[model samples]
Target: MKLIKGTLVALTCAAMLMGCESKKKETSSIDVKDAEVSKNLVLDLSVDKVKNTLGTLKEADSFPRNITKGQKDWNLVGVRDWCSGFWPGVLWYAYELSDDPEIKAGAEKFTAPLKEIAYTPADNHDVGFMVYCSYGNGYRLTGNEEYKTVMLAAADTLATLYNPKVGTILSWPVMVDKIGYNTIIDNMMNLELLFWAAKNGGDKSLYDIADSHAQKSMEHLVRPDYSIYHVALFDEKTGEFTKGITHQGYADESMWARGQGWGIYGFALSYRETGKEEYLDTSIKLADHFIERLPEDGVPYWDFDDPKIPNAPKDASAASLVACGMLELADQVKDNALKVKYTQAAKDLMAKLESKAYFSGDTNQALLLHSTGHLPHNSEIDVPIIYADYYFMEALVRLKKLEDKIAMQ
Candidate 1:
């Protein structure tokens, strides 16, 4: 049996006292449906935005972190940065959408720097973001054998962090205090790399590790209501659960917005790769918990259970991640009612992201806005982030394909 930590008293106290209660107004609204016209409009607008933004970005051997100002200047980060892969990912989506030679070449060039990360050892749990988004998309588009090799190396490195006794991979080996064995919800996203490795004839142990890690996450990181904790701490020697807490969330008991997004996206991908009904069911439950707490607009505050709910900053990246996961979940469900419900939720979220409030104007080169990154540290507050734009574009591209299939039906 699992330890099942987290004091219910703390949860009850946080729920009763946390989350702001305010009815905010939206700047505008658009009805997004599964239609050719609506799909084309969004797709065309996205392609143009991406092309223009890429033009502003300097053509160097690196990736853009975020737009510093109006299209005139941009910030660039090295391959070691956690966000290095998203720039190429957005470019790859552009190539997929338009099939333009310029965009294709740009994607390939930007992805080149990331190949080094595959072989380099990283103790953090974001290797999937670093390698998969860049090399993974590159391989998917071009069938490049080199990209496959890099992915295999990355998967092997990621698997090294797994502790069989703990039943999960270590998320942050070096925390402030570093007293306990820890796993995080974000680690779930990395399992896809392991799943991909096993499927591609790399190693069966990769699949077993991923499966066990996800099962451990479901049992410990997830609360009874399906809201997730940011971290699950374990006793290193006996693998006994010690505590559950949040490193970046507003409070230890609060549900971090981005963590839930990782849970939703990671579990959905797991279900797709393994055909596991339990994973799918867990994803749906998490999605419902997420959707039910959202404000009038589909976007969410940085921390769902934060004390300052209505006044809290919105994390558009989390919204994008969850919206993408919802679309995937909609596709996998056999029940028509569930399929329609989730599909509509996804569309509404996408439409909301494109609204005047969330979408950037000509002033900013970044596509999406109002993302709160590490609010507790007072860093990158209410600014556009690269991953937000990457996942937003991904959701839009996926929505277009879904519309095309609907039209064919």
Candidate 2:
């Protein structure tokens, strides 16, 4: 895969994690103007790609999930599907970057259907994913009062699943009988909704709920080596720790790439909202492990211990999530060396993602390709998944903000 010469050199330095101060200085000398031009070009292309994908949809209520093998269009899902919010989130990001009227209208059209999810009592913890990602971003960008109302109600609905005994949100209520009170690493991502609601006239206790969940996740989900388990089980009656297991990963002992991504992003976000040093430390540790284990290309395999090694399917979704997470982590870090390390790592991952190897480029309606979702279920493997595109676009937006900040400096 081709990468910019400067980016390639910086990535090589980052990968070695040794004495490369001179190399880092040299790569840092690249012109800010050139970086801005490249970033804007990618953002424009992403906006166009989102618009094109909207054209392919026959129903306004349908959401793009993934494009399966041999399929030219997206596999559509209903509003209740776990992935339903990502497409609208993608459109919101596209509009944020481009400010195009057509993209804004599309974002509104798609985000409207998700309002039902806010009021509906959900048995699962994905209400945050289903509502916050769509309406949260919409409310942020547009300040629509209706969007705010829907998000508050969704936050309330999500609060119902938080088990006080477990000190965490129950991720899958249906699985509680079979596996006890199960909380996946992915649930950490949903805490942002609760955090937001507590600040936005919903309920003050929502913040405590989110904080408790993050604290509990840090206590149980993170391993000693900083690698994260996909699922952490707790006894329903006493809230005692049961065990850590895997649902979508290669094995119970393996570090699932996306699960690690969730931990990195979730803790970084928790640190951002609460200014907890332990959360920042956890994010850094998880990020360090993730970066150290990455393949030569900077993107990661679906699972670190999948045993397929050189032949494993790549998960661009995980890379996208980590890129955004590392960028956020960089913003919050006071250590110059660690900040520079994370910033460079994020750039390296984004460079790899923008390459011809991963960018969809008219091959499909999505922005990215080769994301593995539920590989054990034989589902959505090596496909262009919607969340990958959403986070990829969000990472670009974050990168652009960083560049603008540097240019001003």
Candidate 3:
């Protein structure tokens, strides 16, 4: 029943791509707002920082992971790292913005090391994170057949982790707990690669796999209030849902801000691929939930439902991801009021990201600062993560397109 077939599905995808392409074209008649002008200034600064970072990394043989505060050096890691693709992805975004030859070359060079991981990913279900972000962006921006082939192989590898019975991709092969089938809300972001492959050149079963995972996540991981749990455990043999717990949140019951961000982006992307009304509705709910919990500056505490609220660490990555999803959701909705509400919210979030509180000053190598990776382990509590930078740049790219689209209208 999940199977969507033949020319109709293909044509629908084509129309969506065409609409996206049309929005990228610039228009001179549309007046740019003063707030947007300020946003543009921040984006330009970000691009320069990226260029300088890449320039410094040109001598390195590997990709950057993250930087500690007041550190001039970037920590290096192999392609096996979950965050490997983000640097290349950020480079690709820079090229899309400036079309600089050096930036394009850097993007390709950094992507070269990741090609092997597409075929030989570890048992974790993050090939989407490792391959899709790098080569996926490569294929989208450059139309390189090589990138497409690598990404399709990665999609196949990711599919192998899919538990049809459990209806979600396995996030980690081994966890501290002995659960045979473990899934996370972060897995939702991985489905975009599957949907892309299915619509473009891969099997329709890919779409079904992604859809099933989304359906299951909605059933078990999302709370009635729209906050998401970090992890959902299931019996591998029977697909019976067991328990919902938090591996990275403040507590088992707390609302992890980044988990909600993942849900928002994942569901908005699902709506985009399938035109499913339910997906859009759920995305809106998740976005609203996150927005309602934001502090006055719009950046969220690491966990929305945490006890140390006012003193909690800020997660700029969550804000960046939510902003990107909200912009996409704003475009897809038919209700003008909803569209405006989401659009302004996205702009506010972006503005907060550019502010002195969250924005790492010009001296830092990282673009956005104060991201929380794993709070429970006392690891990466407050730092600049590569994924945070990648999403922030991506949100800027999306905001520009939305601005151009609105101007034309």
Candidate 4:
């Protein structure tokens, strides 16, 4: 469980990247709050909400997924569920914020069942979601060797889905027959696992695989306007990109808010890992588009192109994810204007997320409300999703660190 000094330094550097102070220039129209109360209050409230939800789970196998309309309880799922990691991740973040033993115990309990996922090669690309968010954060915070072993195995299992010819990991094996080769914007979030593995005694090629995937995604999934396609199809045999499409968006051409959030966060993290200018550029472009498209409150509708407009369901999840991504992007960008812009955009988004309009409060156990999962399928519409809460807490933690860094300076 003991980390060498090098690994500790790497971890510290990563945290510093997420927590770096923005330039003092006030370029944003949005007023950035300076009070410590605003920062700590939201985080404190989130810890209480997550701890309360943890008390409600009676079954060892159950993990909170979402709360349906008019439903009082979380729709629980098993360890195999893609979202299962977020609840444990939420627990880890809560523990990080409070250093509370009860939350740590709950985090370990929820995270333990997911270790099985590492040993098994997944039929889909979401083993990163199932393992990395749980064991990855666990290992990051606690330096647990068992967690590290699970993450390395999970990363190797995830690597099995990579197609050398296609230059990206296959996102959904179930859809390969129908879609040729499929990669989604969400898969970008999984590359951190491979990058971490490559650095931590796994094959060096794991880094190459992740780097190649990010490059291919940039070439195929990102549009001229820097908006993203939810899915990109390629020839499995020939490794040629066939088409761009959508599975969850309002249309193939419309920007799905959450998918765009994934691109921003994914590319930002990729740039963080590889120090590639192109990746950083892509993240900044996507972020600019997202910021320009947001409503006055800073949260976005489920789809920018959704005909409903003001009537379209607001995706607090998208806002949460983008807020976290923007914080990362803020740290990576050298331009002081961009740094302030992204940092303020993140702050505004978090402000809206913490407001009475978005925060779940006593209305539910989930941290944020009104996340649209897959509207085309009429599923999880305007519900409280676990990943929203996970990223919301993550953004808070990052923002808090930024504040602390500024204070120390």
Worst 10 residues of 4 by lDDT: 27-36
TM-score of every model? Answer: 0.88, 0.90, 0.89, 0.90
Which 10-residue window of candidate 1 scores lowest in summed lDDT? 26-35
Error of 4 at 47 (Å): 0.4
Q: What is the lDDT of residue 320 in candidate 4?
A: 94
Candidate 2 structure quality by residue, lDDT tens digits, 280-380: 99999999999999988778999989888889899999999999999989988999999999999999998888876887765767789899999999988
Error of model 4, residue 23, in angstroms: 45
Candidate 2 segments exceeding 4 Å error: 1-39
User: Which pairs in model 2 have colliding backbones?
Assistant: none
lDDT of each: 0.80, 0.87, 0.82, 0.86
Which candidate do you rate higher for TM-score, 1 or 2? 2
Give Cα distance to truth, residue 385, candidate 3, Å.
0.8
Candidates 1 and 2, the one with greater lDDT: 2
Residue-wise C-alpha lDDT for candidate 1, range 93-172, written one tens digit per residue = 98888878888888888888887777877768888888888889989999999999999999998888899998899888
Error of 4 at 18 (Å): 38
Candidate 3 per-residue lDDT over residues 179-244, each given as its tens digit:
557899999999998999898888889999999998899889998989898899899889999889
Residue 368 error, candidate 1, Å: 0.3
